[model samples]
Target: MELLKAQNIEKKFVNHLALDDVNVSIPENSIYGLLGPNGAGKTTLIRIINRITAPDKGEILLKGRPLQPEDVNIIGYLPEERGLYKKMKVGEQALYLARLKGLSKRDALKRLKYWFGKFEMEAWWDKKVEELSKGMAQKVQFVTTILHEPELLIFDEPFSGFDPINANMLKQEIIDLKKKGATIIFSTHNMASVEELCDHITLINQSRNILEGHIDDIRKKYKSNIYEISFNGEVEKLEKSLNQYYEIIDKTKVDGHSAVRIKLLHQTNENELLSLIIPAVEIISFKELIPSMNDIFIKVVNEYKN
Candidate 1:
C-alpha cells in the first residue's frame, strides 16, 4: 500500500513555476529516493508534502485519504538546512523538540537516553550545540527528527556533514527504521546512496518528474547490452575471435588476467559472443555491465535539455 501520494502537484512562486504537474507514490515501509540536480523543484515538492506550503494545484493523500492537518503528527521531517538553537544544551533542545512532536517529558527522556547511548552521544548531552562539530550537531538533530517515531520520515541531504563511519552508521539506522515499519523519503545528490538504500525513486528535473520506478528496473531499461569478460588468454587471439557484432570498449589487465569490455551491436546476445570467444580462449568469468544511477541521472537530464 502507498503511504503517501502526491498527484498532479503544481506549485508556483510569483514568477517561477517550481513544480509542474509532478506526481509521486511512496510505498509503505520502504525507502523512496527523491532525486534531481539543484533547482529541479525537488525541495518544493518535499515542502508541499510536509504541508509547509500549499500547492497551487493538486492534492496530497496519506494512506488513500486527503491529507489532514493532524497528519503532520505522523510525519518526521529533517530539512536540508539544519536548525538547532546553537546556545542550547543538546539534551535540552532535543527534549524541547520531542515535546513539540507531542511526546511527554517522561517518554522523551527515555527515548533520548536510549538513542544518545546508541549513538555514543551521552557524553555530549550537557554540552551546547555550538560547541559540537558539524557532524556531531547533525547527529543530535537526526536523533530528534526520529524521536517521535513517526510513520513517515523525510530526510533531505541527511549525510551532508558526516565522515564515512558516521555516514555508514546513519545508513544502517535508516535500514533498521524501514525494517521496523517506517516509510522514508530520502532526498540527496548521492547516487551511490540511492543505489544502496532506495527500493524505488522519483527523479525530478526542469520543474517536472522525468523518471520514476524501481531502481533495478530503471537500470535494466537503460542498459546498453555491454559485458565484461576476464580470461587468462592471449589478447591477440581474443581479438581475432570476434566479428562486427562485438565492439571492444575497454581492455585491461586484472590480477594477471586479461579483461575486456564488449558492447553488443545489431541484436547480438552475450551467449553468441561467449560461444565465439569460448573456443578461442579459456573463459574465466563473464558479467554484464549495468549503468549506474549517476550515469542515468546525467543521461536523462541532458537528453531532456536537448
Candidate 2:
C-alpha cells in the first residue's frame, strides 16, 4: 500500500521553477530516500508535502485520499534546519512541542521520559537548549518528532551533527520505526546511509525526478556487468589468456592469489571465462561487481548535465 503519493507536482518561485512535474509514491512501512545535491529542490518538495507552501500545479494524496488538513496529524516532520528556543529548558520545550502535536501532558511526559532514557539524556533534561551541543539538541528534536507515533515520518538531513556512535544509534531507531510499521521519507546527502536504510529512493535534480526506484533494482540497472576473479595464476599467462576478450579494469595480488576486475566484451558466462583461464590459472573465487549508490548518483547526474 502507498502511504503517500505525489503526481505531476510543480512548484515555482517568482523567477525559478523549484519542482517540475515531479511524481513519487512512498510505500507503507518502508524507508524512502529523497536524494539529490544542493539546489535540487528536495526541501521544496518536502515543504509542499507538509503543506507549508501551495504547489503551483499538482496534488498530493495521503492514505489514498487528497491531502487534507487533518492528514497533517499523521505526519511527523523533522526539517533540515532544526528549530528550538535556545533559552528554553530541553524538557519544557519537548513537552510544549508534544502538546502541539496533540499529546496530553501526562502522556507527553511518559513518552519523553522513555525517549530521554533511551538516548541517555536524563541528566540534561533540565538544562537549557543553549547549553547543549548541536548533536544533543538534535536528539531532543528527534524525540519530539517521533513521540506521537505518526504514520509517516519525514527526516531531512537528520544526521547533520552527530558523532559516529550517536549516528548509528539514530540509524537503529529509524530501522526500528520501520519495523514497527512507520513509513519514513529520509533525505540526506550521505550515500552510505542511503545504502544502509533506504528500501526505495527518488533522486531529484534540476527541479526534476531524474531517478526513482527500489535501491537494489536501480543498482542492478546501472551495473556494468563487471566481475572480479581471484585465482593463483602466472601474471604473464593471465594477461595472455585475457587477450582482448576481457577488459581488465584492475589487478591486485593479495595472500598469494591474484585478482583482476574484468569486464566482458561479448556475451559469455563466467564458466566460459573460467574454461579459458583454468588452462593457465587456478580459480579461487568469482563475484559480480554491483555499482554502489554513490557511483550511480554521480553517473546519472553527469549524464543529465551532458
Candidate 3:
C-alpha cells in the first residue's frame, strides 16, 4: 500500500522555483530512493513532506488522508545537514530528541540503551558530541532517529562521512529495518547504494522529477540489448563464427579465453545467436548486459539538462 504520496507538489522561493508539479507515491515497508544532483528540489520536496515547509500548491497524503502537523512525529528524518548540540553528551542528547518525538523518559532510555548497544556505541555515551568523529556523530544521530520506531524513515546522504566498512554496516541495518516492517525514504547522490538498496526510485533534475519506477523496471526499460559471450577457442575462429548472424560490437581476451560482445539487430534471436557460435567455438557462457544505475543516472540527467 502507499504509505505516503505527494500530488502535483509545487513550491517556489522568491525568484526561483524549487519544485514544479512533482508527484510521487511511496509504498509501505519499501526503500524508496529520492535521487537528484545537488539543488534539484529534492530537499525542498522532502521538507514539504516532513512539514518543515509548506508547498505553494498541491497536497501530501499519508495513508490516504491529508497529512497533518502531528504526522511529523511518525516520521524519522535524518537530514543531509546533521545537527547535534556540540556540548551535549551523546546519550543525554539522544534521550532528549527521543522525548521530543513523544517518547516518555522511561521508554526513551530503554530504546536508547538498546540502540546504543546494538550499534556498539555504549562505551561512547558519556562523550560530548564534539568529541566524536563525523561518522561517529552520524551513528549517534541515526540511533536517535530510529529510537522512536517511526513508521517512515527519511535519510539524506546517510553515508556521507562513513568509511566503507561502516557504510556497509549501515546499509545492512537499513535492510534489517525493512525486514522488520519500516518504510524508508533514502536521498543520496550515491548511485551504487541506490542499486544495492532501493526497490524503487524517483530521479529529480532541475526541480523536476525526470524518472520514477521500480529499479528493475527502469533498468530493463533503459536496456541497450548488449550481450556478452565467452567461449573457449582461438580468436580467429570466434571472429569468423560471429560473421553469419550477430554483429560483434567488441571483443576482448579474458583469462586466456576470447570474449565477444554483440548487439543483435532485428530478426536476430538468442537461439539464432547460439546456433551460429556453438559450431565454431565451445560456448562457455552468454549473458545480457544490464545497464548500471550509475549509467542510467548520467544518461537521464544529461537528457533532462539538454
Residues 170-289, model 3: lDDT tens digits = 999999999989999999998988999999999998988989999999999998878999989876876786655567888899998889888887677888878877889887899999
Q: Give the TM-score (vs. native) of candidate 1.
A: 0.95
Estimate, for each residue in 186-299, the C-alpha lDDT of model 1 and write its tens digit. Answer: 999999999999999999999999999889999999998889999998998999999998899999998989999999998778788988998889979999999999999999
Which candidate wins on lDDT?
A: 1
Question: TM-score per candidate, in order?
Answer: 0.95, 0.96, 0.96
For all candidates in order, the CA lDDT equals: 0.95, 0.92, 0.91
Residue pairs with clashing backbones, model 1: none
lDDT of 2 by residue, 75-111 (tens): 8999999989999999999999988888899999999
Cα-based RMSD of candidate 3 = 1.5
lDDT of 1: 0.95
Model 3 spans with C-alpha error above 4 angstroms: 242-245
Pick by lDDT: 1 or 2, better one = 1
